[model samples]
Target: MLAWYTAVVYAVAGAGVLADAGWWPTAALVAASSGLVLKAVWFDPWLTVGVLLDVGVITAVACSWPASVY
Candidate 1:
């Protein structure tokens, strides 16, 4: 039951990202990544690293692009 609930939450969050509703998608992704970091601290440090990498890539892309293009 809990797994089902979590999946539903994640699905809604993914839909929000697809809809391009501004910062909510980024915020949700960050929050979920934080949770993973906490839960997998011992065996899965890569999860946190991946999250940081994602942030870096997004930041680089955003910086490399001009807002006026939007």
Candidate 2:
């Protein structure tokens, strides 16, 4: 399901972070964004925490990125 796919993507992103791969941020951002869309399509009260986590991930990635890329 979408949740499983998102979890796998997040695991890959986490590994990329540990490995210091240049694409980690992009992967994380994509996964987080997809997760947000998924939640929006299938809204649930219990999923609010997940929405917050996705937003946090997006914010972290954006903040840590170099200004030159923007």
Candidate 3:
């Protein structure tokens, strides 16, 4: 149930990223997912995998190394 929502949110955020909708919206989605991740830490089988995926996405977006040089 929640895992499905997480997937949907990720899809939305991914689309926002592709559409150049700014990072704030994506960040908000990711932040919302953070709580879902924590909430699902108990019985959700997708928690580990989903969290890892979210961590990767958030890390990539939050990191500020270079815009056109990376």
Candidate 4:
């Protein structure tokens, strides 16, 4: 049950990112989804921290504005 919910959350977050939605909202959703999944999967503390950090970095990169100055 928890796993299913977590998957759904991740799917929703992925869809949001693919949709090119706003950065903050997408980052927040992804972080929340990852957290839920990590907890549900009972991942090791260090592994979970790593996963979270990766997600945060990815989200930051994705949200970063391009260097092109129109």
Instruction: Tell me how far candidate 3 lies from the true structure as C-alpha RMSD in angstroms.
Output: 4.0
Cα lDDT tens digits for candidate 4, 1-70: 6556656765665666667655435544555656656665787666776566546745655665232310
Name the weakest run of 10 consecutive residues (lDDT summed) in model 2: 61-70
Q: How many residue pairs clash in each candidate?
A: 0, 0, 0, 0
The lDDT per prediction is 0.52, 0.88, 0.58, 0.57
Model 3 TM-score is 0.54
lDDT of 2 by residue, 1-69 (tens): 888888889998988877878888888998999899899999999999999999998998889855443
Decoy 2 TM-score against native: 0.84
**Clashing pairs for predicted structure model 4, backbone only:** none
| Candidate 1: regions farther than 4 A off | 22-70
Estimate TM-scores for all models.
0.36, 0.84, 0.54, 0.42
Instruction: Give me the overall lDDT of model 2.
Output: 0.88
When sorted by lDDT, best at the front, the candidate numbers are: 2, 3, 4, 1
As for candidate 2, its clashing pairs are: none
Residue 19, candidate 1: alpha-carbon lDDT: 74
What's the C-alpha lDDT at position 20 in model 3?
62
Model 2: runs farther than 4 Å from truth? Answer: 65-70
